[model samples]
Target: MIVVTTPTGDIGHQLVEKLLESGASVRVIVRDPSRLSDSIRNRVEIVSGSHADANVVNQAFEGADAVFWLVPADSKADSVTAAYVDFSKPAAQALKACGVKRVVSVSALGRTTPLANQAGYVTASLAMDDLIAATGVNFRALTMPSFMDNTLMQAAVIKAQGTFFSPIDGDLKLPSCATRDIAAVATRLLLDESWTGQEEVAVLGPENISFNDMADIMSDVLGRPIRFQQIPLDAYKARFLQFGYSEAMAHGMTDMADAKNRGLDLGVERSADNTTPTSFRQWCETTLRPAILD
Candidate 1:
């Protein structure tokens, strides 16, 4: 059995669907079983609690051959590091105690970049990877740049105002993968047990596309004049604070965006092996468009 965390999240949900289709025995640790569809609930063993809870992971990991790990975002956390690394400490320990041999985790790109230490949430994610590696479980950190699915977050703005906002420069092209592509890669890794040792699986998308390009794509896809607005770093942090993030947590979000605008996310070059199949436009059509319409 493979233990999956965050199984109801965007990518996790897709990964669970793929694993189910593959006829694999799957188990999930979830905070709310009700969030799971009736079909999913009937198919998999469910541990009903946050995976950050040691008890939940310990119970879920028992007899599991591999695990899909993801630290769900906690917007109200006091610090980004606490949200990522500290929150994952229990689950990492449980992986070893439960004798799980393999783990595939969702992580970030920019390991070799100078900003790794200062990239806020990205820095915390990388640190979480190191902690997981310390457990000696065969680990694959499926690293990715900005997610195209993030567009869904601003869907209401796009629909109402015909625009979206970001701290990153609109003209600066950077790799961004769709969450579905990331899930596809994760599903492939979790199903295959032949791979061992700790490594980063870079799931960059098909190409590097800029926010300006995204606007153009959105305009075409939605048949409306959508625009990309670059908000100031201070404004970005303020926005997070408005969302109830603590001061430190708000700074972390802005710092991560600043690092990305400076090209830290592009530290890892895209290639045939690392790049996944989804493009920004394809994501716009499949994911973003439906959300805006809704």
Candidate 2:
């Protein structure tokens, strides 16, 4: 049996679907089963509660052959480090106690880069990989750069005003990934237990794409003149804060944006195995276009 955390999240939901199709006996730890579709609920064993809860992880990991772990961001968190590293402590302990053989987790790139220690959110996430690895479980950290799917958050602006915004410079090229691509690699790792020890699998998308390039692709795919706007870091933090993010988290986000703008996410090189199949234009056509249309 494989235990999956955040089964209803963008990546987790897709992972669950693929695992079920492979006829794996899947189990999920979810805060609310009601959010899951009837088909998923009926198919996987449901352990109802947050994975951060020790009791929940202890119960969910029992007899599990492999597990998928992800520390979903909590905007209301008191501190940035607590959100990733602290949230994963229970599951780390459970993995040791349960004797699970493999763990595939969603993580970011820049493991040994200088920014890994300074960038608040990335620092915490890299620390999370360390905590999990200390348990001696065979781990594969699906490290990725900025997600192409993040543009969906600005879909409304794209549809209404033909513009999207970010703190990164519009001309600076950076690596990107689709959640679908990440899920594809993750599901494959979870199913095949042959690989051992800990490793970071870079899941960079097909190419490096700038926000300006993305706007051009969106314009072509959506048949409209879409543009990229570079908002100030303070403005970006204010927007997230307006949505109820804590002061610490909002600042952390701004720090991460600054680091990315400075080429922090470009530390990883795009290669055959690491570069996933989805191209920016392909994702814009399939995912971005539909979100804007809807």
Candidate 3:
């Protein structure tokens, strides 16, 4: 049996679908099973509970051979990180206690930088990577680049202002990719059982494009002119604050945007396996458009 956590999330939803296609006996952890689509709900063994609870983790892993883990955001944690290391430590111990070894995880690029702060999810994510490694499981941490889907948060702003705005400068070519691509790689690794110990794979898109190029692509795809607006950091903070982000999260996002401008979050330019990912233009044309239409 294979276990997956955060099965409703962007990567996890796709991962679950892929696992089902492979004819695997998959178990999924979901807080609210009723919210799941009929298709997914009918397929996987549903284990209801929070990822942070040990009993939930134990039940999720009971007889599983491999597990895909994710420490996703929660309603109460001021940090988007779910005390990531603490939450994951128990899961790792339980995975070991269950005598299951093969594991794959979703992590971020630049897990090393001290500047990434607590909400600096990259840092906390890396710590979790190390923690998993120390547990002696055959593990792979998918160090994914900035997700192209995340840019949709700007769609409302883009529609309203005819511009995409961020604290990330329009000219900086930070690496990025579709979450689908990251999910593909993670699912593949989970199924391939040949690799061992601990490994890190960076999900670099086929190319790095700037917000200026992104604007041009959006315009071409949407059939309207659009431009990039570099919002002041304070204004960006204010915007997130209005959404009720804790002050810490607001600053983390703002600082991350500023760091993106300075190339702090740039992913590796090359992949070890030589997998070329979808370009932003193609991702927009093929994947994002239909979602926007729906």
Candidate 3: tens digits of C-alpha lDDT, residues 12-89: 998889988988888999899997789989888998988777888888888888899888763235663555777787
Of candidate 3, the 10-residue stretch with the lowest lDDT total is 111-120
List model 2 lDDT by residue over 40-112, tens digit each: 9999999999999999999999999999999987999998889998999999999999999999999888875
Candidates 2 and 3: which is better by lDDT?
2
Q: Which ten residues in a row have the lowest lDDT in candidate 1?
A: 285-294
C-alpha lDDT of all candidate models, in order: 0.91, 0.91, 0.78
Candidate 3: residue 244 Cα off by (Å): 0.9
What is the C-alpha local distance difference test score of candidate 1?
A: 0.91
Off by over 4 Å in 1: none
